[model samples]
Target: DAMVIQNPRYQVTQFGKPVTLSCSQTLNHNVMYWYQQKSSQAPKLLFHYYDKDFNNEADTPDNFQSRRPNTSFCFLDIRSPGLGDTAMYLCATSRRTSGGASETQYFGPGTRLLVL
Candidate 1:
């Protein structure tokens, strides 16, 4: 089935080390998104790519960055991992309606990160 896929379902990284998490989809959706979710909190939208155009949330931290080189794949890069940065990273895909208001996002299982 066509769906979003996130690699290395679990990750462990040292403080100050850089880590990259990846997402890919086979649904041919027009948008791909990355979200950061901590325990007991809602997932926060970090940014998204609508085709080649990138849209980032205003409150998204400078430490969180994303790259979508093509339609099917996207990556999240953390320059320096911190204990507070540990969270489940979610990847989602969506397609806009012609009216641009009724779209739904499909999310991957998510990749959990643990800071050491």
Candidate 2:
């Protein structure tokens, strides 16, 4: 089945180290979403890309960056991961209709980051 795939289900990084998480979709969706979810908290939208255009949330930190080279791939880069940055990073993909409405998003299993 076509789906979103995230690399390295688990990640470990040292304090102030750089880390990157990647996602790819086989469904050929137009929009891809990146989310951060901490334990016991709802997932927060960090950023997204529609085609090649990037959209970031107002409260997203500068430490986080994203890139989408094509419709199928997206990447999240944490420039300097802190202990507080340890959380689950989720990737999702959705198709936008001609009327400008987006369909349901399909999420990958997620990559869990552990900062040490």
Candidate 3:
């Protein structure tokens, strides 16, 4: 199946500690992205890689970082997870097709992090 995968649908961590979340895709897409959704807010793009080219959303916080070691995998590293870091982290992928302004992105179930 050409889909995104996220492990540990739920995660628990203490405040001020570091946490690592992951995502993988079987779609053979060239772009992979990480987004953070806090409560009912929109999924804000944290960063992404365009076939080894890393692009960070301007508004994304400094505490968030991502790495795509290869085509099939990527990792998100939270250097110091604060209380506000607790939220649903999503991994997404999309093929840069010729869709007009609405190329759909496929998402994984997400990893829910709870900071205590």
Top candidate by lDDT: 2
Residue by residue across 7-111, what tens digits does model 2's lDDT show?
Answer: 989999999999999999999999999999999999999998988989999999999999998888899999999999999999999999999899999999999
lDDT of 3 by residue, 4-32 (tens): 99977999999988899989999887788
Q: Candidate 3 has what TM-score?
A: 0.91
What lDDT is reached at residue 116 by model 2? 100
Q: 29-97, model 1: which lDDT tens digit per residue?
A: 989999999998999999999888999999988888899999999999999989999999999999977
User: Cα miss at 102, model 2 (Å)?
Assistant: 0.7
How many residue pairs collide in each prediction?
0, 0, 0
The order by descending lDDT is 2, 1, 3
The TM-score values for the models, in the order shown, are 0.95, 0.98, 0.91
Whole-model lDDT, candidate 1?
A: 0.93
Q: Which candidate is the best by TM-score?
A: 2
- Model 2 scores a TM of 0.98
When summed lDDT is taken over every stretch of 10 residues in candidate 1, the lowest stretch is 96-105
